[model samples]
Target: MESSERQLRAQMRFFHDLVRKLAADGDPYAKVLSAPDNPYPAYEAIRARGVLYHSPLNTWVTADHELANQVLRDKRFGVRMANGDKVPEFMNFDNSMLGLDPPDHTRLRRMTVPTFNPRIVERWRGRAEAICHRLIDDILAKGGRFDLMTSFAHHLPTAVIGDLVGIPEEDREQFHLLSREITPLLDGVVTYEKSVSVHAALDGMAELFGRIVEQRRADPREDMISRMLPLVDEGSLTMAELLPLCMFLPLAGTETTVNLIGNGILALLRHPEQWRMVAEDPELAQGAVNETLRYDPPVQTYRRIAHEPVELAGVTLAVDDELAIVAAGANRDPKVFPDPERFDITRSSRNDTLAFSAGIHYCLGAPLAKFEAEVAYQTLITRLPDLRQAGPVRRRGSFIIRGLQEFPLSAG
Candidate 1:
């Protein structure tokens, strides 16, 4: 009964805070939470405010490239409060490396680093290429017209991560379903309906991985889970730690790549000359992927909490104060990338974007995501030269992890 009451209180507080923010003027962070189709304008508004605008939500917000980069790399900042309080339950990432500070974060991240090292990721290129070809074959068999996201973008990463994690092919479909249900929690749950659905999805994910861990223990295989089970048994890691890492891996590995492919393809298609460049020289697929990471990245906003009072860019942040680092905005800062608004595949300054973040929390799956995207673009341009948008594009109703929900296209 007390737990139910606490949940109710949290819900009420969330709704009230949401309403106040939406009603408040000049709060670009509020506009971000509203999840507009194009959040760049709100980001620009935040930039206009200053390097560090103390938001009505009581968080410091920044869109400046240098400042955002500083905050990301600063050791004085962390994902959790300095007082060691966990983030709100609705964020749904508590206990994972993403939600941990150093020592724990360092330990967990070290265990997984080799799995996604550039050298290790390169070994999977052939398999990734094979997966892309299989997906394209399926797309072509469907009479040339299909939703790019559902048919191609989502499947490639799902298959690749499934292979890496040892998820049986038969269980892959069900596993992805649970992942999709839980991803929106990254935006932080506001409504009771979303809260209920996400919790249920978390429960389902726990149960699914619980079974997988047990099976891998009984008869280990040459997969990530099998490798980690021994650590859990020996107490180098606890089941509590192991389970969340299991849940985090597939979610992180799949969702971001899904968006990266979708956003990259959509950007190329929108820029005919850029599409032609890649179609003419498929080697430019890597360039297209990099440019897309700058122009329309999968992740837009990253949150950090100040571990101690620190002065930054002429503003002082109090201990435990939160920061909303708008990476998408920083990606477009004219000071860093000349002609920042333009989407140029050949842009010389394309690699400077904060899409994968930086410092201790830099994306662990970045190399794999980039490799998968490079293969995807290379294969699509080579095999489906006639690819073009056939219908309206639909953006995901998310502000932080930006991407498409439906991107209709045809292979002419």
Candidate 2:
């Protein structure tokens, strides 16, 4: 094996051992997702190893926010993780907006950014509300306890994003499955089994998007896809760049908002006093959403690779070294946020909430996602009038994304 590949294998072995130990020890490390802190205990554990742990694939974890900002903003670290030989459950390689670097990144993000811009996303308010209203009605009609994660939380954003991105309501379930198979890309294991399913799903999506692009070409509409056609005509964006954003933008929009809604509600339920405050004045709900992001963000960590030598926190990383910016940890560093452990809904905003990521690679759907969370929560609070956690919130074991897998809730 090449030296980088050897390094990757060595690192993977070490991480596996760490995971095993954390699992055995339980508490903070193993239940990484159970609580609000970044890396859970994972950050501190890795920090103990050193400010930077050699990534098995030339990757290391930079859990410090300032260091994270330095890496993400400095333009030295590339976003793509060096995949030597292993293909985990997801092939985050091509198509997805999150995986690509600049030039191509510039083209892809440009096509969709206009659509997700605050002015445009603000226009999505009515459509987002309509979708939420229908879902809430369905839940209320059932008149019993419901699974918030799957039922209410999951469905609302998918419907909202589907409407916004021109995805037919019928295809959302399929998209959800495809998104689930691919979300593990950040976890560093794109297994063969998942690869088959994910490839099939991606092919189907690409084919579907191809057809849509063709339709938009023949008959333009008032959607983002139509607006993005000029880029394709200009040859700045190829089908690969366009296809991923088409699906990715919508999926990202839905996924993060869904988790934030679920996570925020759960947090308030655990802290009833907070819930009571929001119940009294729904405007505070927006603050609650921001707090939940800091407390437990939907997207956890993102990986970057160094092409040239880079110095971080006095440690000089050799060329080809890998780095994982634990956005979760960066959001909680005590130096950045006072009492980072406490869940204060009204904590003044920090310029950096690595939750949306940093540098040129920041999330495209951030405004849309935040808007959806605020709107969704407001509608629910006003409509449900009394929403509370109904059962234990189950968490998915995947490392990249965090939040409720099953958030059982009731509305009165």
Candidate 3:
């Protein structure tokens, strides 16, 4: 089975590479879509083309804030195909709330709403702060230099989400590694190796979750999985839905929050004044988080398919027509934001950033993610007043999820 899957991924990679090469050649839209690294320039080029650019790949592209906003909220468009089918098989594993539309999406989303409520997430602030300080203490003990991505950003979210999901402490480290291995699935494209590894990692997680489910059944606790077990028994949710929903907790709570911290810190370091602003005044931490979401969001882009004939930016999208809503680009849209290229923590409208997207699909984890990131930034700036980049930062090779794979830093 593994061999067959690898063979399939190789073939997919072959075609994906061919299209990527041709796309990267002369077309800015293609380059933007195919970019392995910063796609900002290509985003600008696409914007220059028009508010809505029809790409050679037969998909609609939009960077304009208004258009992206429209596409996101319009009930005529959705994540699934016109026939109401889900996306490709490889892209569908544990998709959870991400893949559903309308009643189903609403159903699954409502079940998790209380978990991410602002009041509930606010209660996590102390926990997040404690985790942050502990990680920093360990880094401080290690001569003040560490890869922030691994030591701080990644582990912070992993640990918090592990606690939320009620995973045993002994299994948290292995689960963290598995979550990292499977994160590449969030990318727009996946290589043969990544595909195999992600599936394997997910399978391992499924096995682990299966055990947790049984354990929770035998001995219920106050954690999320334990809370949902009764729903499974009462038929409010099936075992299939419940399992994927729990799996999504890590994806929703871990990777994006990790990137939010990693990206926010990187942005502050790159802009010394901004760093000093927050470092001097810890009160500015929330604003810094908002600016970070605006300047370089963790999740860069999203796609939607037209469910029926719909007119957008003077062009009609027939059923099944896909559009790439570049949230990173939308965040930088000059029409919505003054001096969009400038990274200013003081920007009044920074809270309106599309980093968490908009409409019904607005990231369910946004509140918790914001709480985690704000606490993280405040802790780092206050604790490591002289933190600076220690080595070259390595960005994760993902077009969909924008984040660093490695970010060396000196906590001095």
lDDT of each: 0.85, 0.71, 0.83
Query: TM-score of predicted model 3?
Result: 0.95
Error of 1 at 250 (Å): 1.4
Candidate 1, residue 142: CA error in Å?
1.9
Worst 10 residues of 3 by lDDT: 87-96
The total number of steric clashes, by the backbone 3 Å criterion, in model 3 comes to: 0
- For candidate 1, the 10 contiguous residues with the lowest summed lDDT are 185-194
For candidate 1, write residues 43-143 as lDDT tens digits: 88999998888877787889899999988999999999897778766554456788889989999988877667788678889999998898888888879
Model 1 clashing residue pairs (backbone)? none
Per-residue C-alpha lDDT of model 2 across residues 1-412, encoded as one tens digit per residue? 6796566556556655655665556433333423333346776565455555553333467667787777788777676533322223132444476666676677667667777778987888898888788888888889946887777777777776676676655667877777776554544444445555666877777777788778778888777778877887888777666787886777666778888888777777778777777778889878887888888888877767776787877788776666777788778888889988788887886355888887798887787788788777777777876777676667766667776778777775
The alpha-carbon deviation from the true structure for residue 49 of candidate 1, after best TM-score superposition, in angstroms, is 1.1
Error of 1 at 74 (Å): 1.2
Model 2 regions lying over 4 Å from their true place: 1-39, 47-58, 81-94
Q: Which of 1 and 2 is the better model by TM-score?
A: 1
Clashing pairs in 3: none
Q: How accurate is candidate 3 locally (lDDT)?
A: 0.83
TM agreement with the true structure for every prediction: 0.95, 0.86, 0.95
Q: What are the per-residue Cα lDDT tens digits for candidate 3 across 43-95?
A: 88889989998877777989999889877888898889878798666544446
